[model samples]
Target: MAEPQDRAQEREELEEIVRSIGRPDAFVLHEVIRRTGNEELRRHGGALFLSAFAAGLSIALSLIVPGVLKRYLPAADWAEVLVRMGYAVGFLVVVLGRQQLFTENTITPVLPLLHDRTLKAAWRLARLWAIVLAGNILATAAIAAVIAHSGAFPPEIQRAFAEISHQTIAFGFWATVVKAVFAGWIIALMVWILPATGAAATFVILLMTWLVALLGLAHVVAGSVEAFYLVLTGEASLHDYLWRFFLPTLLGNVFGGVALVAALNFGQVAPEVEEKKDADGTG
Candidate 1:
């Protein structure tokens, strides 16, 4: 009886300790993200491009899954809500699969650049961004061509694809840009939060992506898949894709990731980091 009571009390104390463990603070999150950025900066160009291409190809699932959902679901009002959940599929694949995404690069690489600020660091960041963005765009273009030309899906599902693209691109240039900013901001915020989320990472990713889809936010790579599909299908012109969807979204995403996430976060932790470095005689 005495031994059993002691075990119970010990178990209760262990549970209390687990419950009382606190989440990492801003300084720790900043360090985690900064270290992640530094590692990415160190990767070779070919590896970065290959990973980014895989990410672009993987991200098409976000668009494709929604099209599938739209085709079979009822035409009821709540159906759209259910369909939006599919938007999270590709994000889950790319993020958790650890593929390189261009928008993610927008935040990850920027952290190193913000911290280092050397000409060499700036050059590395530029190279990383360019390679990743190009790989993502080219891969998305290829998949869009395949979807448009291949008879993989019946005409009905193809129509569903068209509908999704149309809705994504219908927001004019500025509106799409504004929405893209929110999308970028949310994605960057996800990156920042991920270092802290342990078992709930998948839920966090799904929730962030679903919010973007449900709110009609424009994501550069995912939206590119949609916009490129329209162009390849001859539903929209190359000019429309370049002008309305591509340019504005790229601009907004870069700004949102760099200015909003990288800048603000670095700013907040800068003083503390500098003070610590100075105290350690490393500054």
Candidate 2:
């Protein structure tokens, strides 16, 4: 009896780490997410915009939660670690809600293109990307403006927001791009892992997104909330928003998600896909 209870407690404490090793069947998972990407491409423009906008608005929790925590938590070695958990809250909402997040699009939609390799498929992927990216940016910009101008929070929380913005821009362009690459890689990896572990999706999202905040990596949508806040408050320039934050992070994210994760995973499964097609007389 004691042994079972002890194991249960251990699981509660270390649930995120239990399934760290061992991967799912890559080909099977690819097909599953590929179908998801296909469905996203077929969504009407209005529905896609609304979903992406919701995702942008939803991710605001990631920024706001950390800032609020920073304002209240006692400054200690472990305080920031605990505060970073807020990053997962926004991701949890975005992922689990099935909202159309742009970074997620970088990997999922590309799988369909890689498999189809047709002009029509490529065009659809590009269209989906453009709509989602535009919606995400517009929503984050709107929310940041409200946060900066609305004065809903106390001055202490506002200052915390400013500090977070300062940290986000402390890195130079190349440095931020590199960090964003890692951020993109992780986000795409999380998307890939989710279809495989339906039961552990929440833990995976929390662990991966929290890792982004803990490591101080640049994420295009989430980081833009801080950039917009800084710009709105006159602490940063519009040039800073474009040059210092947006451009590099976007490039890095696309490269990391499409080039590194999606392409490689597709490459691994391509031979098997072709083999199966030949076996079925569909090649």
197-233, model 1: which lDDT tens digit per residue?
8788999999999999999898889999999999999
Error of 2 at 142 (Å): 0.4
- Per-model TM against the reference: 0.91, 0.90
Which segments of model 2 are wrong by more than 4 Å? 1-24, 279-282
Q: For candidate 1, list the clashing residue pairs, or say none.
A: none
Best by TM-score: 1
Task: Report model 2's TM-score to 2 decimal places.
Answer: 0.90
Q: Which stretches of candidate 1 lie over 4 Å from their true place?
A: 1-22
